[model samples]
Every structure is written in structure tokens, then in C-alpha cells.
Target: MVKLIGDLIKDVIEPGFCLGCNACVAACPMQCIKKEENEIPVLKTGCINCGICYGQCPQVVDPKTLQKAIFGDNPTDELLGTYTQALAVEAKDAIMKAHGQDGGAVTALLSSLLDDGYIDGAVVVGTGEAPWQPVARVATTTGELIECAGSKYTRTPLFIGLRDAVNLYYRKRVAIVGTPCNIVASWRMQFSEPTNRHLGETIRLRVGLFCGGVFRYKEFLKDIIERQLRAPLAEVAKFDMKDGRFVIYLRHKPKRELALSAVKRYIDLPCKICSDFTAEFADISVGSAGSPHGRSTVLIRTPTGAEAFDVAKKFRKFSAVELEKVKPGIEGVRLEAKAKKGAAAKELEIMRRQKKPLPVWLQERPPEPPKETIESLKSISRV
Candidate 1:
């Protein structure tokens, strides 16, 4: 339906609705698009109006249609999307647990999928050329998974590697792990009208990471880490956001902390309007929220996700318990998801009051944002 570049810009881009998922950049048949600031894509030339970008954009695709296409029903929940089960899990292997952000469930699960023939490869985010930056990669081996293990609190145009996974590597079945927007785009690419049926066929599993908002890594790294701390990038061993502060760990030096309120200024614009926190459409969604420091909360959304978990268990890849056993537990996740929904609803209201027409995705509110959500744009402006 979106036949022209102008339509996409007006409907999604201009409204600050583009999620920077790179679906448009990747789907461009002419390769006329490239990412700017390693975030949103910019057209390299004049309009092509090929419609491929629109066909793949999650912003304009209706979730009801996507739900019916994926699950054959419109069953919905006010929070946490459509899911069958929720649990807390951690990798069984010591090595996996050591390298991953939390329990290393993603790395462990994807490794099992790769070994057990469930998927030939996985689209993952790894360290970019610069410190604290994220780069999309396709990992087919355990070593590759380890390389991408830790969290990068930033957005990576992960699906951009989908083409290489299919056309170049010829992987018939592949898994993909991404934020909510990335998962949405993957599903829409499969079922949307005039879809890339081939790519959809190759997507064996969709894994979503729980996200609140992703900060601009370049700004956080350059402005805060380099300018404020004057720390050498190589000496910085890890960066994390926990307990309302951005924690920077160095190889031997003392750690540094920055309040989340201050860091909120660098959050991507599209993240403010997001409507899915737990990646409701993903086969399995995993996040550290509502779990122990060394564990991940896993939301099994579909039969496929359950099947993958079973296979991972069979391989002795992870150990999981009922979510009820955890301290924060399912209630913690629910409250966080609800808070994000509320914030997004407020954002939409402000947009409407300002006479700004919203795109289809943002016009509706009330679902999805990861943990530690920003409360008010007004508060952020003061920052």
C-alpha cells in the first residue's frame, strides 16, 4: 500500500515513528539506503518507491493481522503480549553463564538450536569496532555466540544481516534475537501483504530482548565515557545499567556510575513511543528484569518458543524454575510493562494535543516498553 518514499517518510519517518530497526535499509532492493549515526537509515539517492521498505516496516503493520497470521487467532493480553508460559532461566554451562549478560539464556538457547538443527544460524548483536557500540552479526557457532554474549544497551539494525544469512551463507533456517521493534519487523516481513515470503520462510525462530529504551551508544560512549570520565576505551571492560545508574567497569580502575535520569537524554526518539516491552510476538522473549542478578526471565509466547526451550533443556543448556520462585517475579515484569504502556499512552496524548497526526503504530498506545522506563518528556527536557 505504501508505494512511495514520500508516504513512508510522512507516515512513519516524519512522525518520529521509525524504530531504527533497519528493515527498510535492508529491504531496499537497490541498496540505496545506509544507516546514519548507526541508527536510522537515510536514503542515499532520490525516491525509488519500491515499497519494499514499507512492506517490511513494523511501524505501519497492524498487530491484529500479524497475530492472526502467526498464531491463527487474535488472543491478546493487556500486557506481555500473547504468551503461553513464563519462567526464570539460566545457562547450565559455566562458560555460557560467565560471558552472557545474565543467565546467558540467549547464547545457550541459540547454541542448542544451532547444534540440534533447529536453526542453522542466528542473527545477533556483537561489539562494534568502537567500544560500547553494537554491530549486527550472524553467529553459527558457539564461539560466535560467546563473542556476542554480553548486553549492549543500544540498538543494532540486526535484521540487516538477514540477507547475508540467507543469500550468502545459504542458511535455510535461522534464529534472530532483537528488541521488540526488531521482532515486530521480522513477523511483519513474514505475513504482511506482498511480504518477502522467502525470508519469512527462513526465519525459524524470533527471540526478543526485553527493552525499556536504548540510549544512543555513540553519545553515551563519547560524551559521557570519554569526555566526562576521560577513560581509555580499551580499559573499559563492561558497561551496564542497574539500580537506576549506568555502571562502567574498567579492567583495573574503579567503576563509574551515571544516573538513569541523566542518561535519558540520549535515548533514541523512536524508543519513547514504543508499544511492546516483552516482545509479545516473539517465539521466546528473554530479559534480566524480574529475575536474579545471574538469571533471565523467559517468556514463552508460542508453541515454537516452548519447543525451543524443550530442546535447550534436552541439551542441558539451561536450568529454569517457575517465575513465582523469583523475588521480583512475574508481578515485577507485569508492573514494569504496565508502566511503559502508561508512559507511551501519555506520549501519544501529548502528540494528539499538539495536533500531530500519528502513524498507525503509534496512533494506538498502551503496550510495550522494557524496564526502567522514562517517566516524562518534560523531566527529560530538563536533563
Candidate 2:
């Protein structure tokens, strides 16, 4: 009998229909799947059937349910404010100061988890030369967490690490720091075969960050090109999310102000479809949205998250930023969200289609792309 990979992850049979896209076949880690004509993926031997393809498939047999399942329930009236709240967590290690984008709140949280023996390792999205590099970084020390700091704007698809994370647990525990989609991967990973024993036992924490939308890494690079003079990607310094704008820094300082037309073309697909800017699924959603430099805007969800923040508060790792500076941006986000509800998605569609790709950076690893000053990071870093 022909078996479907979806059966392993869920009770429902996986969709047999195909968009004839080779995404799943190309993405399969086990090399167990093959693509036929019209992008129909055929299962093969050694098919551990990890079900990675099920998530990557563009054609959803079930759109409404699928979209809701991934996005979670829509906004309620009470769910105002950013998805994250401003708070601190005890990350005693000094690594928090160096790694990450700015104030290093995420580094601190991961360190606390590692030091407290709460988790053996964590799954996070580390920036790579290209995109979609969502692998797990086993953090045995605080320094490791710092090394993999910052909010990687590209779609890291971090959920892919669940299987590996379970392997590393060795019956211990692990934490996950990711975006909403990454968290969605976690939720899906729960049932996706070989049932993760560690998931129930040791996958202890989930650290999330306030997100505007999910975008494609390719689009981001393309945007860089539109801004630069079609330079090759030399280095990526920053993906600044301040003032309601996403500022991309490239290595070639000469061609700074890229054409706005190019940027529109390179924006990702999901962010265009999605309206949720804040992640409600995360344990603690953190950001620099409203917080001043050297600070982070944190939102605590679970009790553990609140407790973690409480403990971290004692260290005085960050100062507070005035809410006013961030207010305009947040307001802009709300307006954007509102626009997403009806006609705006269409407007974006037109804008996207008409937009042209900009230029690429000249070199790789450009000078640590400019980061907001420590004082600025501190402003958003704490409660």
C-alpha cells in the first residue's frame, strides 16, 4: 500500500495534489522524496518521512483551516499593545553584553535557561550567508547564546530543528527561541512522527519576539539589491525595525539610499499575506519596537516567562525607554494591521507585482552592520 508522510504527522492523509513546485523535493533532508512532472512529489526509500514537505507545500488543500491553524485565532478586542511586554530575565553570564542585536535580552534569557539547568540546549535562527538556516544551536554556556543573538529577520523556519533538538535532549531538556511561524512549527512538531519524548518532558521554554510579518530571505536580499547598486551581497549589517521602517544596511556605503521601488519587489510573501505583527504564541515575546536604545520591549506570556523576567529584573541589565518614541511606530503598525483587513492586501499585491528588485551589496560580512547604540538598545531592553 502506498503510504503518505502526512499520516505520520497527523491522522489526515497528506494532500496528493501538487503545485508541481520542487520546493519540497529540494528541501527534503533525507532525500527520500522525488518530484515528478507538475511538481508532484513521490515518496521514496529511506523516507524517514519527516513531513517537512507538508509544511513547505504552497498549495494548501485546506486554506481557511490551515491558515488559522498556522496563524492561530485572530485578534480579540482586549489584545491591544505589542505582543511582547517590557521585562527582564536573569541571564547572569557576561555574554549577553556582546551577542545579539543590541541590549541582548534574548541572550540573557537563553543564558538563564542554560545556567539554571532548565534546558540542555535551544533551537534558534542564526543568520547565515543565505537564508532559511533555522537550525538549533546547542547552548551549553551563556557565551553560546550570545554568539547566536539578535532577531534574524529572514524566515529561518526554525521548527526544522525539533527532531535534532529531541536527539540532543538525551532525556534532559531544551528551549526554543523563534518567530511565530517558528512556534507554529513547534506546535506541528508535537505530532509529526516518532513523537518527541523530550518535547513533553524537557523542551521547557519558548522565547518569542514581536514580529511585524514573516518575509522571505530571498526577498530581503533582493531588497538590498534594489537599495544598493545591484551590488553583490558582501555583508549584512542590520535589519533595523525602528520608526515602522525596515532599514537594511549593506557593505557598499557608497550606494546607500536604494530605490524604494526595488525594496517593494523584494518584500517576502507571507508578510504580505499576514497581518499579525506581534506573536502571541511565544512564552516571552521581546523586541526593540517601543523600548529605547540599550533596552528591549518584552512581553511575558506564560507564568514561567513572568518568573524569568522577575528574576532577571534584579540584575538591572537594562534601563527603560520612554513609550512615546515607540508609540508612533506601534500606531503605524496598528494602521498597517487595519489596512491588512480589507483593501490593503490588494494594494500590496499590486505594489509588489509592479516593484522591481534593487541592487545587492558588494561584499559579505560588512562591518557588523550598524546597530542602534547601547543606550538606544537599553531603552527597549527592560520593563
On TM-score, the candidate that comes out on top is 1
What RMSD value applies to candidate 1?
Answer: 8.1
- Work out the TM-score per prediction: 0.88, 0.63
* Total residue pair clashes for candidate 2: 45
Pick out the ten consecutive residues of candidate 1 with the lowest summed lDDT.
374-383
Q: What lDDT would candidate 2 get against the real structure?
A: 0.48
TM-score attained by model 2: 0.63
lDDT by residue (tens digit), candidate 2, 281-337: 555766665554665656665555666655645545544443444544345434534
Candidate with the greatest lDDT versus the true structure:
1
lDDT of 1 by residue, 120-157 (tens): 99999887777767888889999999999987777778
